[model samples]
Target chain A: MSDFQFDKIALIGIGLIGSSIARAIKLHGLAREISISTRSPLTLARAEELELGTFYTESAAECVKDADLVIVSVPVGASGAVAEQIAPALKQGAILTDVGSTKASVISQMQPFVPEGVHFIPGHPVAGTEHSGPDAGFADLFEGRWCILTPVEDTDAEAVRKLRSFWESLGSRVDEMDAEHHDKVLAIVSHLPHIIAYNIVGTAEDLETVTESEVIKYSASGFRDFTRLAASDPVMWRDVCLHNKDAILEMLARFSEDLAYLQRAIRWGEGDKLFDLFTRTRAVRRSIIEAGQDIAEADFGRHIRHEK
Target chain B: MSDFQFDKIALIGIGLIGSSIARAIKLHGLAREISISTRSPLTLARAEELELGTFYTESAAECVKDADLVIVSVPVGASGAVAEQIAPALKQGAILTDVGSTKASVISQMQPFVPEGVHFIPGHPVAGTEHSGPDAGFADLFEGRWCILTPVEDTDAEAVRKLRSFWESLGSRVDEMDAEHHDKVLAIVSHLPHIIAYNIVGTAEDLETVTESEVIKYSASGFRDFTRLAASDPVMWRDVCLHNKDAILEMLARFSEDLAYLQRAIRWGEGDKLFDLFTRTRAVRRSIIEAGQDIAEADFGRHIRHEK
Candidate 1:
C-alpha cells in the first residue's frame, strides 16, 4: 500500500485494455481504489462479478468524480463523446489519458473536451490478443510490452511523468511520440495488417472454389496468422480504420503497388527478385527476435517442452 | 534400440525439413541408422558438425543404396533431380517417401525416376518455421503436428502403412488425400498466405512514405506476423508459387476481389460488413485452436511465458 502511486484510478471502459489495467493495478497494488464504468449495464455487471474494480458506476462522470487518474479505454471513434461526458466531472488535478490505437485522431477528439487543469495524454499499449471484454483480461498482459504516449506541446511535464511512471509500474516500457507520427507508424505496422488480414480472411470466406471447411482444415500454413490478427475486436478495428483513413490509405496504396510488382515478378518467373526480397525479410524476423519483440520458433517452444 | 522401426533411413537434401527428420529419427530412436546427403558441401559439413546422421555422403546414389527407408526432403523443384540421382541406387522394395508441400509437383517430378520395386509415397508434414538450413532442425519439430500423404492408387499398401506408423512415431497425426486436392487445399491455406505475406512485406519495404526502420519498429502491431511467414524459405516458396500457379492465381484473384470489397466497405463506412467479416474470421481462429493446429495464444504462448 505504501508503494501505491494513485489514491484511486477510474477505468472508463472496462473492456480488454481497461480490465487488464484494473487487473495489473490490483496485482501490483498500484492504486488504493479502482472505479469502473462502461456504457452497457451487462458489461458493468460482469465486471462487478469479476471484481475488476472497487466501485462500479453507470455514469462515466460518477466514475471519475473523485479519481486521481482517469483512463479512457474505448473505441477510438468514441473518444470525443467519452471525453465530453467525463470532462465536467474530471478532478482538476487528475491525470487524464486514453488507450486508443490511433493517437492523432484520438487527440483531436479528446483535446476539445478536456477540462482545464487535467493532463490529457493519449496512449496505446501495443499489446493485445484477438479476444476482448472484461473476461479476456489478465494481469500480465503488459509485461515486456511497449506502451506509447502521445503528449502534445505545452503538456505539463509533471503530469506526463506521473502517467509514465504509472504505466512503468504495470511492467511496460513507455515511449513518447507525436500523435501524427504515432498514427502514421501504426498505419504501416498495425492498421494495414489488420485491414489486409480482414480482407484476406473475407476473401477466403467468399471463395466459391475453396470450401470453408477445407480452409479450416489446412489453415496451419500461412492463413492462420492472418486469421489471428483479423480476429481482433471488430468495432475497435473498424473505428481504427475509419479514424486513421489517410495514413491507412497511404500505406494501403504503397502495399498494393509493391504487391503488383511481386505479382508480375512471379508471373514473369523473375525468381531472383523474389529470392532477394524473401531473403531480406528473414533478417527482419531475426531482428524482431533479437529485439525481444517475438519468439524465433513457430512451435513457440512451449508445446515442444510439454511434449518432451 | 528394440523399438526402432527401420534398420536404416537415408535422407536426401539435409536442409530444414530433411535435417528435422534426421533429428526426430535420432531422438525417438525410430531408425537404427540415419544416412544424410545434400548437394551443397557447406550444408553437408554443417549437418555433420550437428551430428544429424550416423553416416554422411556427398552422393545421393551412395546414400540410399543399402537403406531400408529413403526420404527425399528438398525443394519441390529439386525433387526430380534428386529422384533421378538416387533411382539406380534405391534398394529393392525400400519405402521411399518425401516431405514436400506440393504433392502433385513432387509426384509428377519423382514418379518416373522411382524404381519399379521401390514404393514412392508423396507426403507433406504441415509444420515448419520461417527459418531454414541444417542448423534449424529440432528434435521435437514434428510433435503434435499433421502429416498429409498423397498416395497413388497403385502404391503398395504396406509402404503407406509403414510411413504412417513412422510419422505417428514422431508424434504427427497422419491423413491421406489426393495429390491435386492437396495442392488446392494448400494453395488457399498455406501457399496464398505466404504469397500475401511476401507481397505485404515487399509492399512495406518499397514504401517511400514510411521508412523501413519505422515498419520494423512497429511490426508487433501486425506487420510482424507477415514478416515471419514472408521470411520462410525462398527457394521452397518460389517453387510453390510457380508449380501451383493456377490454384495460387485463383486464390490470389479471389483475395484481391475480397480486398476490393473490404476497401469499398471501409470507404463507404459500412461497419456491419466490416464487423461481420471480422467476427467470422475470429471463429476460424477458434476452430484452428480446437483442431490443435495452433496455440490458442501467440505461437504456443512463447512470448507470454518467455520472461518466466
Candidate 2:
C-alpha cells in the first residue's frame, strides 16, 4: 500500500513549524503535493527559494485551493486572520488544523470561520527552538515530541484518527484532550516558563548595580540558561501571553506565591526550608529524563569543556 | 623556566570543583603532587578510585600538611568548618584559596583562621555543571571560564600573583575584585537564577490544575530549560543560599519586584510592554554569545530529537 495520506497539503505561514511540517511531509512522502503560503512576501520568497513545497503563493486562499489538508502554522495572534482568509477556499471534507502554542485561543479564533463540513482540529506540537524562520527548521523537529490535539466534541471521529496518524507519520506521539485542559497544562509547562525566562533576563538587564557586561560575562554560571529561552521569537511569545492570558496569569500567580515563600525563607536564613525545596525540585528533572522528555546527557551534552 | 609552581597542592574537598582542579593541576604539570581530602569517607574513596590526586585522606588537616597551595573546594556553608580543621596544619607562606560561589562570607569565615604567614585569598570559578561528585570533574571545567579572586588588602602581592598564574595555567581568565563586589555580582548572576529555577520547578510540581505527567510530556516547549538548572546539586545550592543570604536576598527582592511589574503588564494585557521587554532581553543573549560566555549554537546545540 502507498504511504501517501493527503493528495495536497497546504501549509499557511511557513515559519519554523510550518517549514518543518513541509520537510517532514516531503521526507516521508506523506503528501503528493505541498503548497506553502505566508503573509510576508519576503518570507514567501524565502520559502520558495528553500523549495519547501511544490507550490508557493503569497495568498492563503490560493494556497489552500483543492488542498486535502490545510495546516495553519502561524503565531496564535494571527490565527483568526489566517482562518478568515482561507475559510472560503478550504475544500469540503478537508481536515483543517493548526500548530499553535495556545490551543483554546486558536480554536476560538479559527472555529468561527471554519466551514461546517471541514474538520477543524486544533493542535500544538510541543517542540521548538528559540530560533524561528524557515532556515531554522529541520525535518525531524517533531520527532520524539508530543503533538497534542484538542478536537471539538462534534468533530468526526475518522477525521480525528486520520489527523492523529498524520502527526504520527511525522514521528510525533499524539494525544487528545479538551481545549481547556490543553491550555491550562501548556500555560504551566510552556507559556509560564517563557514568561519567567523573559522576565528574569529583563530584570538582570535593568539592574543598576550590575552592569550588562558583568551579567553576560558570568552568565554561564546560571543566567545563560534563562537567556536561551528569553531569546525566543518575541512575537510568538507575545501572542502566547496575550491569547492564553487567564491560564498564564493563574500559573504566574502560583509561581509568584511560591517564589514569595522562598524569598521569605532566604530572608530568615531558613536553611532547612530552602534545602527541602531544592531537593524536591531535583527529582522533577530526573522524572523528565526517565520519561524521555529530556536527554540524559551531561550539560545537555554541550561539550562545553575541551578535552585534555 | 619550569612551569611547576607548587611542590604540593592540597584539595580539601573531592567534589566537582575539587576533582576538576586536581585534574587540571595534573594535566598542566603545575604541581609535583596533589593531596585530596573530603569529609565523607566514601567520597575520599571514590576520589582515590578515580586516581584524582597523588594522595587521598579523610582528614582535612592531613591533606593540608606540607602543601604549598591549599584549595578548599567545599560548599560555602562548610568553608569555616574546613578552615578551622586545616588551619593549624597549613604550611607557612602557603597560598590558601577557595572556590566557593560566595566571597564576603567565605572570606569572613576563613580569614580569621589563617596563620600569620599563610596568604588567604577567596576565589570563585564561575563554572560548573548540574552534575556533582568526583566523577563529574574534568580537566577543562575551568577552560575559557572566569575565576574571580577576592584577596584581603594586607595579603601578600607575590602570593596573589602565583595564584593568578595557577588559575591561568588551568585555562581560566582570572580577575580581581573586592569580596563585597564579587558577592553582589554573583548574587544577580548566579544565586538568583538558581533560586528562581528551583522555585519555578517546585511551583510546577505543586500545581493542582496540571498533572505531573502532562508537564513532563510537554516540557520541550520551555519548562525543560529551567529543569536543567534546577537539577543542580541541592546541597551546594542550599549552601549558596545560606552563605550569601544578604546579597541573595537583595537580588531576590529586586527580582520579585521586577516580576511583579511584569505580572501587572500581562494582567493588564499590555502587549507592547511585553514585546519591548522580550525584545530587549534578546540583545543580552547576543551579547553573551559575542562575549564567548555561551555557545552560538542553536537550541543549546542539543542532539535532542535524534536517536529515535
Candidate 3:
C-alpha cells in the first residue's frame, strides 16, 4: 500500500479538469513526477507560472513519454487528435483515461490511436465550474463527486483497478459502466440541461420586449441559475452538442413536447396539471438532496454562500 | 427614526415571503404589532407555534383592522379574494402592498377591492428559496436584494416613499416601475426560467431509455441546478402561470423558436454556430455576476454552501 505511487503521471490539456487533476496529484503526492502539456503556449506558460506540474511541455508526445498514468482532459472532439499525438510516447502498461463528458464518443475518438499495452479507460469526473482555463482549476474540484469509467470488454481488470484507485485518491467515488449506457445517462443528466440552459439564456438575450438590463438586474429570480451552465466553455459544450447529437436531440424533443403540453395547459387554465407537474418535480429535488447530490437549503443556500 | 415604524402591520399570508417579512419585522422592530392571517387554520396554528406575530387569526378582515400597513403575500390568483376580504377593514391612509411575482395581473386582481384611501402597491421582492412554508424563511431573505414596486399612477407619493423605505430597512434596494413593465420584466427573468425548469425536469422523469433513478444518481451534472427551481411551491407557481399567461406564453414561444434553431445547429454538426451562440451566452452570465444578483463562486458556490 505504501508503494502505490505512480513513477510518472502525464496530463494533456490543462484546462479546468486537467489542471484540477494536476493540483490534486500534487496535493496527495500521488506521483513521483507530473508532466503537463496543453496546445496553447500561453496556457502552458500560465501552468508553469502557477507551478502546477513538475514537467511542462507544449508537445503532448514529449510530455507523455515514459509516463505511468496519462489523463487526457480535452474537448470530446479533440480526444482523437490528442490521443494520436501521445500514442507512441505512452509507456507500456501505462493507464490512459479521459475526463470527457461523453464516454462513447471519447472512447471511439481516442481508441484507434492507442498503443497495444496502454490501457484506455474513458472516464468523466461528472464535476465542473462554469469557469474554464488553468487558473480556474482547484484541488477539490473532484472531491466527493462521481468519477465514471467506461472500459471496453477486453480491458484488463488490474489496469481498471489501478485507474479507479487513482481517481479515488483524488477524492472521487468511482462507478463503472458501458460507454453507450454512460452516454445515455449523461444525455439526460448533463448535456440536455446544459443545452437547455444555453438556449434559454440565448432566448433572453434576444428578447424584444424585455431589455437586457432588466434580465441581468432581476436575474436572481431564476434566470441566473441557467446562466451558470450557459457560462461553461463553448468549445467543450459545442463538441458535446455535436458528439452527443442523437441523445441531446432526443432529450430536446421530449422536453419540447412536455413544454408544449405545459403551454397548452397554461393557455387552457389547467391549474391541476401545472400544480401536479410542479409538485412532482419537487420530490425529485428532495431525492437529489437525500442522495447528497445537491444541498437541501433554499436557493442553493445563496444566503450563506453569498453572505453580504 | 425610532418613531418611523408602522404602528401595526398585517400580513395576510404567512408562507415563505410573508413569514420572512414577519421575521424581518421582528428582527428590526419595524412594527409595533404584527398581525398574521392565513386561510388555512393549520398554517395559522403553525405560525402561532412559531410565534411569528403579535396577533394570529383566520379572518383576513379581522387581521387588517386598524393596521397601518397590510401586506398580502398570497398566490397571484388569490390576490383578488384576499383584497376583497380585507378591504373594508383597512384603515384610512394605510399602506397596502403585495409580494406576488407578477405585477400587472396582481394589480388587476387586487386593485378593484382596495379601499379608496388604501395605497395598493404591487411589489415583488425578487428573492426566495426553492423551499416554501413558514419554517423555510429567514430575516436575511431580502438582504441585498431588489424589491420592485409597481405602484399605479394614482398612488400617493408619500405612500410610495414610505413603502420604499420600509423595504430598504429590510435590506432591499427598491425600484419603482409601471405594473405592466414589471410584468414583462418578470416574464423573462422569472416565469420563463421556472417554466423551462419544470418542463425539463418533467421530461427527465418521463424518459424511457434513461431511468429516473439514473437521473437522481447523476444529477450533480447541471440537471440539479434546474431541480431547485422546479421544486418551488407548486400552487404558487401554478397561479403565476395562469395569471401571467400572455407574457409567459410569449416568452415560451420565443424560447422554443430559439431552441429549434439550436437543435438544427446540433443536428447539422454546425460547431461554429453552436460555439458562437454558446460564447455569446457566457457574457450574460458575467453580467449577472457583475450586477451582484448572484454569487460568483462555482456551482452556485455549492462547495462552500454544502460542506461535508
Clashing pairs in 2: none
DockQ of each model against the real complex?
A: 0.57, 0.73, 0.84
- Per-candidate clashes come to 0, 0, 0
lDDT tens digits, residue span A1-308, model 2: 55689999999988889999999999999998999999899999999899999999999999999999999999899999999999999999999999998888898898999988999999888899888899888888888999999998789999999999999999999999999999999998988889888988988888888888889888879999999999999899889999988998899889889988998888888989988998988899999898877877767776552222
lDDT of 2: 0.89
True-contact fraction in model 1 equals 0.63
lDDT-best of 1 and 2? 2
Instruction: List the candidates' TM-scores in order.
Output: 0.94, 0.98, 0.98
Indicate whether candidate 1 or candidate 3 has the larger DockQ: 3
TM-score of only chain B in every candidate structure: 0.96, 0.97, 0.97
Name the weakest run of 10 consecutive residues (lDDT summed) in model 3 chain B: B299-308
Q: Candidate 1 falls in which docking quality class?
A: medium
lDDT (Cα atoms) of all candidates against the true structure:
0.84, 0.89, 0.91
Writing each residue's lDDT as its tens digit, candidate 3 over A1-308 gives: 44637989999999999999999999998988999999899999999999999999999999999999999999999999999999888889999999999988888888999989988888999889898999999998888789999998799999999998999999889999898889989998999999999998999999887889989989989999999999999999999999988888888888899999999999999999999999999899989998888888788877876746
- Please report, as a residue range, the 10-residue window in candidate 2 chain B with the lowest summed lDDT: B299-308
RMSD (Å) per prediction: 2.4, 1.5, 1.4
DockQ of prediction 2: 0.73
